[model samples]
Target: MFSGLSAFPLTPLNEKGIDEAVFVRLIERLNAAGVDSVCALGSTGSYAYLTRHERLRVAQLAVQHAGDVPVIAGIGALRTRDVLELAQDAQKAGAGGVLLAPVSYQKLSDDEVFGLFDAVTRSLSVPLCVYDNPATTHFEFSDELHGRIAQLPNVASIKIPGVPADPEAARARVDLLRALIPRHVTIGVSGDAFAATGLNAGCEAWYSVIAGLFPQIALAITRNAQAGNAREATGLSGRLAPLWALFLQYGSLRVIATAAELRGLVATPCLPLPVKSLQGEVRQRLAAILDELELA
Candidate 1:
């Protein structure tokens, strides 16, 4: 599993399918910025939005251009069999590991969640990281469930979101996971807003959204926390607060895509139709914010 700044890239897309040229450019930019690892088809990548074949091709594209950097493919799907097939295909495509989250068609029991991961991990030669994103999955894991999952063979990490809305609580939660989970299993803090606090509280990795647009900012925060520079990390996180506010209000996918568009990184604000990217007043606010940060 990825142990440092693992950027969740927004898969640059065209109206019909994946935009190969723009996607390649994004990966090349990430590699040039020296992100520790990149996760293709993550929540930001809109994994569920793509066809199975599109997902496979996206992984192939990412792995081909990853160079020396490790690529972790998101293998989440609504069905167990689909996730399993995706994991196998990811390994075949030379992905370093697979990021699996229990996607629900209906509310899942704890046993059902365990079973889904168990089936996928057992079938994989590569490592598996459990994505513990309750907001999207709507299945919050209990502490006991987390321990049980961590002990699973070839299970390598857990991603926990830490938004600034709940800093002390987020830190306390990270602290508990640090104590409860095995040393071998890394805990990654997602939610770019609260990453600094989570990192200071001892999260081993950051699964970041901001890094998809501004890797240097993301890398600096992680490095600062790793070096015990809490003040510096906190400051960077503060600078990112405006963007995070937009994320909390409008979702990270939309805001990050707007940031990419503002920078001329992608051709158009590409999201699945009906799920619009930022527009009008929000777009103007985002442009102003990015300009203030000198990121536009």
Candidate 2:
């Protein structure tokens, strides 16, 4: 469940609430693309914005539509109690795994973060993926902390941030983490721009934002890397440099939501409240880039 390409689909929203039909189609798209797993409520899915009931419903919908593909439901919340409840909800919804980040309004100490995972992992029947998205969670994980959390029961994977750009350094970073964690716990990489580098450097999985919308290309790169065709994998990622640039500049959530809207995959302004869709010249440029890359 932790290996290969894990696509993080957006939870498309409408005036009433979650656009259930659109969300189902997105899951079906991922399933059709043969992605290794579907992550229903990751950062790209706007998991943080959704209420507990909404998240549980999304998890259930994803599992229902995903068919054979394993569904990893995001179970992050500000309080550990809420996170635990979400985890139970995910398990009840038949999620294959749960992705958890130490979400905090107040900065969390290492012990507090460790406690969060320790508490959740104990009650979890399904495997748990440690979601270390420092960009969104605002809590960076030290390698030692990752090692500690990984030691707990049911910890299947650690979704680490992107590695260093340099080839040797990237490998070194991954290697260092590998040594810390147990052999059974897979190391997955986030950051769409660094997928190729991280995969080639020995990351077992790519927890991708772009894959949610453009699974074919993401799968090509992941398969190439997994097959040990480094050049092909790198080339495939290089072609998407324009898209990656936009992701870096505008944040992946906004860029991908905009792309989904442009492609007619979802309604205009599909994002949840307080998170507006892209507008004006940048939106136009995104369209141009999509066309130039033959991604539209």
Candidate 3:
């Protein structure tokens, strides 16, 4: 049950398999930045693009470089058995916990969803953190269902995306949903764009993509917000506003991949086939912002 800023490093891919040297260098840089925690093979990590062997290799590298800090292995798949096997692999690879999401082509009923979680909980040895990314999955869990799942043992936390930009509405939602979670269970915000508002609305920690390239700024904002420096946090958020806007306005996946490229964190920001790259104004805007921030 790790908290605070847990950065999901984007696993750079090339024509070959898992770019080992680049991946290792990225992990070492993130660890040296004093990150609270790191995750591999998540959505940002391009897990869907990797094979089973590649996922396992990346997970091993992440855990190896994580040192004492907790390593969260993102084990998400369309099949129950496959997800379970990956979870088992993560535990064997020295991961501290597993981040599971309901990944299925057919939209399942609440009963089916509950059943899937029940089986996963019973099968895994380590704690499980459920990821609620409705944008990608198109199935958002109701608070009632979350309340039921939170009661189970070995369930560590829930990752909720902070949709609906209005801070007031977002705050109300967080407060209500947080009540459904047991006192011991932690709540994290995954929407990097609205993370500041989410944190102000009672989120204990967050999962950020921006932290991959600019961990120092992300860490500064986290510390400021946690220490009750609202103005400072808001100011830092403004500094990051350009990048956030690009992710929201344009292609989020491209912007994220490009950030790694601009920072020289990865050899090439090559996304999976069918996922296009940014060009012209979009690429120029991202590059200019990164330059302004001196991320290069």
| Each model's backbone clash number | 0, 0, 0
lDDT by residue for model 2 (1-296), tens = 99999999999996579999999999999999999999999999999999999999999999999999999999999999999899999999999999999998999999999999999999999999999988889999999999999999999999998989887899999999999999999999999999999999999999999999989999999999999999999999999999899899889999999999999999988998788778999999999988887774
TM-score of each: 0.96, 0.99, 0.95
Q: State the C-alpha lDDT per candidate.
A: 0.86, 0.95, 0.80
Clash total of candidate 1? 0
Poorest 10 consecutive residues by lDDT, candidate 3? 268-277
Number of the predicted model whose lDDT against the real structure is largest: 2
Candidate 1 clashing pairs, residues 3+ apart or interchain: none
Which ranking of candidates, highest TM-score first?
A: 2, 1, 3
Worst 10 residues of 2 by lDDT: 287-296
lDDT of 1 by residue, 1-296 (tens): 46889988888886777888898888888898999999999999988888888888889888888788899999999899899889888888889989998888799999999898778878988888889888788888887888888888888999876634455776778777767778889888898887888888778889998887789889999999999998899898898788889998999999998888878988785777777789999999999999998884
